[model samples]
Target: MVSNQNSKNLYQALWSSADILRSKMDANEYKNYLLGIVFYKYLSDRMLVFAVDLLEESASDLEEAQVIFTKAMDDGEVKDDLLYALKDEFSYLIEPSLTFTALVHDVYRGKFQLEDLAQGFRNIEQSNELFENLFEDVDLYSKKLGATPQKQNQTIANVMKELADLDLAHQGDILGDAYEYLISQFASESGKKAGEFYTPQPISELMTRIAIDGKEDQKGFSVYDPTMGSGSLLLNVRRFSNEKGFINYFGQELNTSTFNLARMNMILHGVDSANQHLRNGDTLDGDWPTEEPTNFDAVLMNPPYSAKWSGEKGFLDDPRFSMYGVLAPKSKADFAFLLHGYYHLKESGVMAIILPHGVLFRGNSEGKIREILLRNGAIDTVIGLPANIFFSTSIPTTVIILKKNRPNQDVLFIDASNGFTKGKNQNVLEPNHIEAIIDTYQKRVSIEKYAHLATFDEIKENDFNLNIPRYVDTFEEEEPIHLGELAQEIAATNDSLAQAEKELATLFGELVSTSPEIEKELAQFRQLLHGGGLE
Candidate 1:
């Protein structure tokens, strides 16, 4: 078992590997290489452990096991059995020649070749259909790594040596969380592109908790994120559900590189390949997860804000949008994504999506869609979050929760904009704030100034507008003034001013040797004290 101290040490060691290449490339470019190598180390360690266990199973003692393993390395039958077993178990295999331990030792001995590790990645990618093209983003030969082959080899060697010092095989979440931590650090540094691949952790937590509130104990519980970025949001569902219960994870990412990151994140966090189904494609244009049924137990998303899509008339027949009878405008695809995910959601499941405030009040096609969802009682709750809470954009956002066939057509509106604690760079929703919102949502009651339950009649009376302030009144009134206290305070201030003027006059008389200009200034000051100064 790995101790807490050992885990912390491992995280620090793994993270420092980036410092070696910090000057050579930006986080966007260097992340692929750094994380790819760390994943390689994990795969290598896993294979070695499996091999050692296989050797120990048949031998009498540990020393005898090592001797048997050494002898088995030269036997074709043993090699074939080990390869088949490892491939079946891990969906990939690493040979002794290209294992991370072997490569690190080779670098120390001045006999390392970058091609060996590159070939290892290729072989793994080819070993199983699940791992195909997984390492396509890791380009060791890119100029970003180094200019020349020898220089690239040295740079990689330096990173390898730094990573080799860390114990990544610890039986804990240390390595996986460290990888996530590094991804977040890069996201913070990547600016606009951060939103393309990352959703801030706090937001992910809040959305996941709300989506999985009443369905934690259900067997074979599954969750889906249509716009899954880095697979963080989809993976967050596991924390709220039974850990031993097999939960199927599904997601689709538009960007190829981000899609690869999502896959790598899934594997690094110990999610079996059989449980993860991620696809790289345009989620809005394509029907995703072609192999599985559409309905999911919970659907969560934080898609690109107001993204553009082809709202052509051809989509009028698309089952996802056909019922609405109008497509989301070409300029903003927010509703398009919602409707797509909504089509795939189980009737009993809940969907909580993060979108900009415009979706709540935008006119034209969006308004029509809002009216349809409102009339159908699909919109469950609208939560207003604080601004500057997201790293990519500072616009105030809202989480729109939807449930199919909710008996009570009332929509719960929560005004949590002022609930965040201010940070140096961004506002943050603490755990208490998150729980408060969830508690109020679960109880389905109105809290003064923070939440309100807007009945269907009231919403229709307001013309189906779900703006938060319209339902929850957060306006604070000013305090009343006291004229008597004000008069007494003014009189006291006048007396103090008179006393100050007299003292200043005496002091100026004692300093008669000063310049005439100083004397004139003091006379003016006295006049001002007596309320006789020129304006």
Candidate 2:
């Protein structure tokens, strides 16, 4: 376990490395290098610590462990055996010369080369399937780092020196959270592009809690996120689940860079490679995980809102969207993404998806799908979240909770759009607000204006719009104004105004100006005040 003070120190150290890259590139581009270096250091540090523990020696720290390992590797008799043991323990082996500690030593000696670091990354990528091309996004030779090779090497060296003191081996449990913190900070700097790879933590927590409800203690619980940006949303299941290590994580992402990010996130979080089933492909273009146990217990998503898709006619026959009798519009594939995840849900599972509110009121294909989902009781709840909570878009969004084989056709509508703390750059759902929303969702009872449980008949009466306002009334009526009291107050105000003007006129009459121009101006002001023209 990592202590609070240790975690804070690690976060500051990791974030400070960004400053070295700030002048070289923007946060969006520099995040890859920073995160890649941090992850590499983690692997190297862990390797040293694991090797030291395996040696059963009293190594004081990683530096001593590195020296011992280097001397052991120098001995031809023990080198091969040590390499075999390391491979067995870590599923990959880092050379004594290429470890982060060795590289830091090189940096101090002014003997570091960019190729050495690149080779280290390549060595890990080629070692095992789990780490294959994991650092593909970290382009060492990119011109963004510097125009010349020496400058790039120096920049990377500077960043490494800044982060050389991070005790990743001891803080293994909290490293993943610190990595997430850096990613979020980068997202804040990336602006709209943040949506491509990150979901706000609070939103992720809410969706995870709702999806994992009633199944926290289930062994081997499985969760899937079709757009598993950074794999943060999928990892949230472990936080709310009783079976942390036993949960299976399944996810897919379209962006290769983001796909790699998800892989690193999972590894840093200590998710077992065997339990991670992530793919890099379009979730809508073709269905993945077409193998056994495809359906998951809890499916959560925060895909691109209203993104364009192929939406071909062939999708009508595809099982994921076929049941709906129509495909989601190409201009807005929100439902298409929704149906894909919903299709992979277990019969007893729960799913929660965040999308723009347009899905609830849009007509045509989306409206038809909404109508069918409502009639079948698949749509269980509609939660209207606050606007500007996301870094991607400022428009308010909704979380539509769905369940399979549900008995009731009633949908619980929660208007949580107004329940959030105002932030400098975005609205925030504090812990209490999230609890309130989850409480309403679990109770399934109607609050006066916050929530409403509408029956199938009520939805039918509204033409199956599924819009939240149709079920929950969030309109706050203004206090009534009395004409008699208003008139009395206005009259009293006018009387006071007249009395003040009279006093001002008396004071003006008593003024004795030395300058003729001032006296003339004072006389004109007095005339205007007495004539009631000032009003």
Candidate 3:
């Protein structure tokens, strides 16, 4: 089981290594270097563990086992057999000279070279089709590292030594959690670009739970995220299942760097490379899942909001959009992504997508799309999330949950916009808030002032607009006041004021008898106080 202590260790280890690279470049640029080294160390450590296990049959301890394995690797036949077996299982192999431990040892001995690290990346990528171009983003010789080769080598050596001290092998989910921590840290620093590849953890958890609500015990359960984004959201689905290894993961990322991040995340989490099918391309422009009428059991995504698309006339014939008759407008592809995911949802599947509020009320092509989805009962529930929960934008977003083959047309609306714990940088959905959403969704019951179950006629009465406020009344009523009581209080205040004024006038008369000039000034003040002109 994953624990908070493991997460803390991973965060600290990655942050400590990040400190060495912080002064050299921004988070956006330094992340590639930092994540690349950590992934390399994970692969190298995995190889060491495999070799140590194999050597334990003949040797007494790990140190003595390494001596025997080194002698075995020097032999041609034995090396070929080991490489074939390791490559078949892991889909990649690390050489003794280029392994992470070897590089760390060189760093301590003051003899490490940047070229050896670069070659190690090349060798791993060349070993199998799965790892091709995986290290393209990690440019060891980039000027961001240093202006000179010698300086670049020194900088990389420091990172290697810092990462060498971390024990990534024992703790569950340490490497995966560390990679996620680094990605999140970089995303927070990357500003608007963060939305392209990362989704906040709380939102990911909520979506995953919603998607996997009733599919906890099924065998061979599959989950997909069309807009995978570092694969954190997709990986989150596995946690809800009783059998983790029974789940197969599928995802596509538009960004190459983030695509690699997803792949690294999958492998570090103990997912076999064969179980994950990740591709890099525009999710809207092409038809994926082309492997013979494939539909997933659960689909979860937080796609980019209102991104522009071609919306060409040719897409009218595409099965994903053809049924709508009018494509989603080119200015807003929110529904376009929805239709794409909906097209791949199984008859018994559930899909949850995070989108802007405009998707709920926008007219024309988007409205037509909403109408068809509502009539067909594809939209199961609409959840309004708090504003500023995302690092990229503060726009209040909604999670639209869809299900196919439904017998009823009722849609559940949850007003979670007011359900969050405020934070310094961004609002957060606490555990209670998340559970409230799930409980209400699963029970299909309405909570006072928080949720409402609307029938098809109620939605159509509002002209097919599925806005939450129209269905759920979150309007807070103020306490009522009694006009008669207020008037009596005002009258009592006036009487008290009049009595105080008379007492003040008596005190001024005493001062008038003492001095003539003072009495003249006091008379003017008394006249002004009694509503007479000061002049």
Candidate 4:
């Protein structure tokens, strides 16, 4: 029952102290020390609760024995069995002195080696296989943290001691928020490398809702993002709640570090690992989890735009590409990722992915893939998003929603590029813009200036190019040139020029723009030059 203010306060207490490490070391290096110890503290707190509950259960069972001949209650003799059970339960205890704070405190007092603390972390991780390799060896005491073991220990001590003093209760999403803050801060500082993985939260939220389509009660659901960097897409699905709902998430990432980050992110957000298959492998190689081919409910992906992949090695037999007849080029894997998403999609599931505009009308294998999908009525919706929504890549991307089972044989195309607000660095899709796109998806109805529903034959006639402008007719024809109207417009322009010149002359003569302060100074100058005489 933590209030939002309380959560904010807790975050401020911990994250505000991260500036201490900003000057001493790289933020990415300091992340391990900060997050690793916080995770340790969380583990210890939960374990304490577990042990206390287990002991209480044991004590209740033992007290039922016919040994009620010990301490006297107010009315009569009471059973002593409860006392003995409590003592036995204390044996399975983690000493309070060994808590995360205690270790940090000892480091400040110069009484402990960092190796002991590192071993303590390993032991805590070993305490539960449920969290095996939860952090991918954060190495809080490794040289990566500092210049040497002692220096690393000192840095860790300072960071932990600062964080340990914070009041982060194990109640809600405080940890997740803190972790997200760290990631965002890293994104701001690390530039391209960090930007490659993390999509801004607002953008991610919009993408997830568009893909989920107001379904709230749907469980056993599966969603995915092939380039699931830090799992912003997967986590945002949990934020989706409508009259109908979605249940689970699934994703695969090629970068081992980013893969670990996604898994850690899911865990911090309280998503059960069983419900998410965040495998660490290249998705292009079909290195995805191959157990169940088409059991997913919805698949959403923002695969790296135009990234090179192994797409030319007889990929026609890769199962994902075999039916498409040709693999995408080695340089542009956009169609390849889309085919993989389409391959794993259930018969009724929807696949919405962000791709560069080139993928819509690219000739060759991509065009072939487009023809195959559209011919099968897999193309359901095509949404054009504003440019620069994704980090690292500022190219405007499109969302192609493919449905295996379509109730209609038409495609919905929405042109939203001109519908976004301009920001300082990039264009942004506000909440209303996202809502408008989702509304178009649900309605499948065409609008006058925004969306269009093109028939399958129309797409075929257009050579199967799914570009937004192909279906959505946003062309504004210029008014027919009128000779009389042009002559009148030219006369008006000449009149305006004459009026502007006259206004400028009179305004300069009066000089009314200068105030009384300047007028007083001018009077002094006139007195000095004209000997105080009126003209």
Top-scoring candidate (lDDT): 2
Two-way TM-score contest, 3 vs 4, winner: 3
Q: Scored by Cα lDDT, where does model 3 land?
A: 0.85
Query: Local distance difference test, per candidate?
Result: 0.84, 0.90, 0.85, 0.68
Please give the distance, in angstroms, between residue 311's alpha carbon in candidate 1 and its true position after superposition: 1.1
Superposed by TM-score, candidate 3 places the C-alpha of residue 327 at a distance from the truth, in angstroms, of 0.6
**What TM-score would each prediction reach against the true structure?**
0.89, 0.94, 0.88, 0.78
lDDT of 2 by residue, 420-471 (tens): 9999998999999999999999999999989999989999999999788888
lDDT, residue 491, candidate 2: 100
Any residue pairs clashing in model 4, and if so which?
A: 215-244, 215-245, 216-244, 216-245, 217-244, 217-245, 218-245
Per-residue CA lDDT of model 1 for 122-160, tens digit only, reads: 988898777788889888887876889999999999999
* CA deviation > 4 Å runs, candidate 1: 1-3, 57-71, 243-245, 483-535
Ranking by TM-score: 2, 1, 3, 4
Instruction: Give the clashing pairs for model 1.
Output: none
The order by descending lDDT is 2, 3, 1, 4
Better of 2 and 4 by TM-score: 2
Window of ten residues with lowest summed lDDT in model 1: 59-68
Candidate RMSDs in Å, in order, are 4.1, 2.4, 5.5, 8.4
Count the clashes in each prediction.
Answer: 0, 0, 0, 7
Span of 10 residues, lowest total lDDT, candidate 3: 57-66
